[model samples]
Target: MKHLLTLSISIFFITLFPSYSQDQSDNDFKEEVKRIEQLTIKSIKLRQQINPEAEQEALNDEIKTLDATLLKKVTLFLNEYGWKSKKEIGELANMGLFLAIQHSSTEEMESFKDIIERAYEADKIEENSYALYIDRLKVRNDLPQIFGTQYYFDEKSASLRFNEIEDFKNVNKRRKKVGLAKIEKYAKQNNIALD
Candidate 1:
């Protein structure tokens, strides 16, 4: 009787929690893709409306709330499931992740570097996008930027230009390698004449 009871319990456990198959993983990933897509769209819209100088404290508060919530969700998803292939979630969701990372603390950003690097190597994210992130991290650390994304306009001299770069001489070569436009062209677009 005891042996029969043990057998029944083992069978019940197997029936309740079957082994996960590849197809099951794929389906689960697909569902996650949909969820991330929705979150990305809402977050992007909120981000665009944020203006610190304007009297929109309510909107700013909403952005902070969403950022906190989305950051937690994104971190958890990345940790548990890892990055979904580009084909699964597409560019929009990736863009949303980038924005979330941008709003995160320096420590969080550093922690996500491995995942982001893997995605870049797998061609999930574009080279230009990768360069932007690298440059942002450099700026955060007070190191010279490699890709020249962060810039400021000199009010006295009336020029728009990047901050200090690591290697000023080879900047264009590095920029070209990463799919960024030439510095002169970028300056012109921003209506600043390069000296």
Candidate 2:
């Protein structure tokens, strides 16, 4: 009788957990592990094989974009801590990046290290601050930018709702109207992009 009761309990559990039985299959788990391992290896290889020059160029573009938007928010952040330009903010970003090392994936840690090393080469920032700032940015990805082009900053609301979004209707109403005067003056002065 005891044996029959135990057999019934085993049958009930098996039926209750069909997915678990399949999950425990050796081939299924091995394939999953193999795929994850391949991805991790590829990320590591890319991090190691990329040249600093290519990375620097990318970072320059990023800084330019950030200048138009993120730089303002970062400026506010630095002001709270007392800082000025991108060069100074880079040091602050480094400090955040360093703290992020503890929670980062191996590939992320490598990139953080690369950023610090590159900053050192450029003589723009100290290693300690570089580490810290990067980490802070990673954690604050959700924060809205308070600076940059006033147009974008004006659209941000603490909460967005159907009616509240209408607040953006005139967000750019007061934005500086760029025209021939500015464009021509800028282009002729720089000898660059033309219309």
Tens-digit lDDT track of model 2 for 49-116: 53432336664554344333333332333334432223543433433323234234445445445545
- lDDT at residue 135 of model 2 (Cα atoms): 32
Candidate 1 lDDT over 114-156, as tens digits, reads 9999988988778888898898888889899997777766666
- What is the lDDT of every predicted structure here? 0.78, 0.39
What's the CA RMSD for each of the models?
A: 4.0, 20.4
Best by TM-score: 1
Residue 40 in candidate 1, Cα distance off native in Å: 1.4
Q: Global lDDT for candidate 1?
A: 0.78
Score residue 181 of candidate 2 by CA lDDT.
Answer: 30
